[model samples]
Target: MNNRYSSNSAGVFTWFRDAAEQGNAYAQFNLALLYKRGKGVQRDDKVAFVWMREAAKQGIAFAQNHLGAMYYNGTGTPPDDSEAVYWFRKSAKQGDASAQQNLGLMYRKGRGVPQSDEMALTWFCRAAEQGVASAQSLLGEAYAQGLGTKRNFPLALAWFRKAALQGDATAQLNLGLMYRRGHGVLQSDTQAVAWYRQAAAQGLAAAQRHLGVAYAEGRGVQVDLERACSWLRRAADQGDVDAQFNMGVMLSNGYGTRKDEAQAFAWYHRAAAAGHMLAQYNLGGMYAHGRGVQRDPAQALVWYRKAADQGAPNAQFNVGVIYANGHGVPKDEARAVAWYRHAAEQGDASAQNNLGVMYANGQGVPQDDAEAVRWYRRAAEQGHPLAQYNLGGMYASGRGVERDPVLSYMWISLAAEAGDETACNNRKLIERKLTREEIGSAQALTRRWRDAHRA
Candidate 1:
């Protein structure tokens, strides 16, 4: 049948060429399609463009639409958005559905036209009403995102269903997300999985990634790490950054696969290069700890800085540690303080405690006992054991706040409960200095504080 079809097309090619040369618009359009697709004629985009332009000039709506696409895509000519919009508008005004959708895209993206969500919506609605699956999906997205109108989840779901049923992969993926998120319908992981499966089967990388996550988390299915790894690997192979990062996590943790630090590092490097924040942080850890690679503190700092610049508090804290210890660089206490402050301001307990030590020791900024106590208290309130011990020492020595033996005993007791050996020994020493009544008061305060702060 394929051979017969090709033969039949070849038989008609001469007739189409003759009629097109005679200025017949319909014949020119047919000949253009043949040249464009290499069906019954040698493929030549330049020849196709010539014939398509002639037909379009003759007011053939579909030919005008095709010519607009060629111009937009730079097929056989330099790309020209303005000219593409001109032809698209001409065909769209003539009720060509494809042209209407193309015009909507131009307005939506501000390509060869002023960006106008309302105009894009109007045109998308026109094409979608004609049952164009891509246009329907775009309309769904517009409604879902409140691009032109107020968010209408129900309308978005309706359009997504219409397009998905027509086998549009993007619509299938979006419909799966809608089901998963319960946007306009009851949340149903089973339904989401079904839609995701369809889209994934179509080779959609994002759908594969979503399905991989679903399998890993046991949403709508039994937990199957192997299946999750398979799907994630598929997406990662297709250059999906999230999937690459997930692959690093799974490989590093030996989830459904043999633990392979080198592979994990490779995957993390790929994702980090693409600007995945978590991947960058993990890559830093790998470099710092010599996991799957030679220890390289300089490289660790580079990756940590990348994540820190993106506002990762843990990375900021790590950057401060590196600078403070002079790991792969000159020890710069002031720079350490700057980095520590970045993380501490975001309520990182470890950073708060470290900042307190810097203040108390005059290593970075001036030695200020009050500031040290302030930072230490913040971390202590968060149940940081080291901060509790440090704060207790400050109270005992009268370096910060008023001298209060009972308060010092209470803080030391909390740290001792956390298994700090130094706190336990210091607590025993403090106990000897207090009278029986003061000791009883400190014990009661410790009990009350523990009860109030229990997690």
Candidate 2:
């Protein structure tokens, strides 16, 4: 068939129908786009695919990429991850940045292909180096989390900066966290606010929440509770749980706005219902304390259980306390210890200390001095004051550790100055026995440990 001139799109199709039938690749691709998008024709994905297949076979990169996107997104095609991957690979091999990024996403999520972080990284790096903004942001996250490469904060920051400079909202938010936390750059709250604002203006809910916190805390900007609440409400409207939870906290605490327990309760309930674990814990506290509503211990227990089941540290600790004290449920020391142990393994200092006491007293598990010291020491290293005090006493009495009077005096002296009366008393007793050289060595150890953790 010979190519024919046409005046309008419909007229072009009449001419193109013949050309497409005769396998003119350009005509086939044009007709396919029309069919695929339902422009000037009844929508027919099957027919569109047929024409696209013909055009793609003729080395049409755009057609191949479009077809791949369709398959990847399950638009006008049966959902087939493997088929999507095959099409994406075909287009990506032709240096299509979008295809490369999409292929990386597929590999990263294990969608329609075996999970391969390295493969994902390869594709993402290729597209990012090609200046694809989304790919740059995705690679930044992968690097930050050490998903496919060695943890390299500087490299992550570099990728985030590239994407953020290109106006990528997610990258802007990520850069904000990196800068604010001093992850790969100097801590700069001012810089964090700048990035957060850029993303927030783009209606990114996560950024809105972060911006609200900055305003509330007066970190990089003036503290304006009203502005913080406004931003938080905007994010909450978008169903961001962190925003919702923080907003409730502000309301309850009377920060920026008049205190309103009822309104706080409502926001906490909504966020808790949305499966926000922290909100669940907060909601439980409100219910248990009868702050916003009528006292309902059962309701409190329900919310606490929700958070506790998800392994929230504070929630687990609180739930254990509630059980032990018979606040909402029957006094069950056994249940309390179980909850404490769960949180303790996750390195919750309070839980570790409490569990140690439970073991030392034979409250839930069998009493074992060794277990008590083990749990207490774990908490003490993290600076849980009570655990530090308890550990020092155990050392002095040789209850859990080897009875080395010098070491005992050394630990007691450290805890005593940190305000543990038991340790202070023990230190006084040891002072009578230790020589000046041993005392000097213990003081030096404390100085070194303190210096190492100063900031």
List lDDT for all candidates, in order. 0.96, 0.87
- Tens digits of lDDT, candidate 2, 207-291: 9999999999998999999999999999998999989999899999998889999999999999999999989999999998998
Worst window of 10 by summed lDDT in candidate 1: 1-10
Model 2, residue 278: what's the lDDT? Answer: 89
Residue 13 Cα positional deviation in candidate 2, in Å, after optimal superposition:
6.6
- Candidate 1 local distance difference test against the native: 0.96
**Distance from true position, residue 243, model 2, in Å?**
2.0
Candidate 1 per-residue lDDT over residues 1-455, each given as its tens digit: 23556758877888889999999999999899888888887899999999999999999999999999999999978999999999999999999999999999999999999999999999999999999999999999999999988999999999999999999999999999999999998999999999999999999999999999999999988899999999999999999999999999999999978999999999999999999999999999999999988999999999999999999999999999999999999999999999999999999999999999999999889999999999999999888999999999999999979989999999999999999999999999999999999999999999999999997
Off by over 4 Å in 1: 1-4, 8-10, 435-455
TM-score of each: 0.92, 0.73
RMSD of 2: 6.7
Clashing pairs for model 1 are none
Give candidate 2 misplaced runs (Cα > 4 Å). 1-22, 35-38, 41-51, 152-154, 325-330, 343-455
